[model samples]
Target: MSRATVLACLVSSSVLALTVAAASPAQAAGVDYVALGDSYSSGVGAPGQSGLCLRSNYSYAAQWATRNSPATFQFLACSGAETDDVLDSQVPAMKSGADLVSITIGGNDAGFAPTVLTCLTSSDATCTAKVNEGKAYVANTLPGKLNATYTAIRNKAPGAKVVVLSYPNIFDTSAALCEMSMTKRKAINSGAQTLDDMIKARATAFGFTFADVRGNFTGHGVCAARPYLNGLTIIPPQNSYHPNANGYTLGYLPALTSAVS
Candidate 1:
């Protein structure tokens, strides 16, 4: 080839190689993580300032990410989030190039507090009916919302590994401190389990990892062991029915770490 043509060809090859290298998946030198979810992921009732400063030092996602430090962490979780909220509010907070993503949502989709209040107010039969209604709300509404949220995340940051965490059983009616009846608590827990199952199934279909915190919290649920969750008018002052800092530390953080690892 002529000298000029050979020079041009060499320059073109170098530029093409550089472009391909730049487009390659960034090595795991460190991960850029974005966390999305509801109260549980927001660290509600944990020892920290609430409101816009929703994140706490003990949050499982934060703890897990920090444990593997040097990671670029952006936690955009909020309290009182429902399925629609994740799509409308949280999804936009995610940025491109996130290498890892974690989400915990759907607890508030069925209006968990109101459902619990109904159970607390009613007799066993009425409480059972209300619990069934709550179950139906979760089963019918949450899966599609979760799927959409995951799909959106995949589109924004195609290389990230996503993990969706399920809610833990929050009622323990058998405890002396638990004012609600055991039957009502059992029904509520059953509904929580059903919700967890739905999240797991949907996350699996989307190729995201499912963290089964429900199963991990079995005996340690609100009433069992030492009451992982605070009860209405309980010792901890943060909230009536949410996980304590210790609960986040012992229960949720470990499970989250396992899923991410």
Candidate 2:
């Protein structure tokens, strides 16, 4: 994210925060961590998970808890969560005095999954239009949604070091021959960048750390030599475009660890 964009998001968040009664800093001690967000945080494509939420032990949140042995580690992220879902459902269930919180959100709000499906199953023009739609949502609407979500999180876990992790670009445009056309791939990746930028801006505005995973995911997208994210799938459609177990363990875990450490 650029300085100007970050400044814009900060101004937005500051205005929103001013409207609400200020929350007290969390006084609770010990390692009490909570994970909240959508499928990317919930570990949709990773194995060893169950139920509609698909909470996986292989998720970066779970993996971090396992390695560090926090006093409490609640993996509350669901597969298809939007920002509203986090505010109305997930945040209510979170422990109030959490010392650490991590989230990956905004993609579903931008309608990224459906956009990708359009690219895969529709014409180039249709794909481009859908990608443009997602970009617009990310650029214009997602910041407000993220601000609300981040505000709720700050209220819920005031002292927690909130690490807002970003989504990686799903495709490697450099791939010689991929399933989607080069144009579609580049467009989709561009949209993903827009979404990540919005998320980063808002997260930073709230004084939270923004973990950019795109660098770690380089050469490891859908069509790369060692893909961390899953490509399209038929039997289990929800798994499509989500990170594989390796992505959480390798791509996401290291990012979170570095951010918090």
Which one wins on lDDT? 2
- Worst ten-residue run, lDDT, model 2? 13-22
- Which stretches in model 2 have alpha-carbon errors above 4 Å? 1-29
Error of 2 at 43 (Å): 0.5
RMSD of 1: 18.4
Candidate that scores best on TM-score? 2
Per-candidate TM-scores read 0.82, 0.88
lDDT of 2 at 134: 88
Write candidate 2's Cα lDDT for 37-69 as tens digits. Answer: 988898887887688787888888887776677
lDDT of each: 0.70, 0.81
lDDT of 1 by residue, 1-261 (tens): 443443332222110011111111233337787888877887865777355636776687766665566358888887667777778877777878798888887777765766666676679898888878977877887777777877887888889889888888877555665567788888888888888888889899989888877655556666665666766533222345667776677767766667765
Model 2 clashes, total count: 0
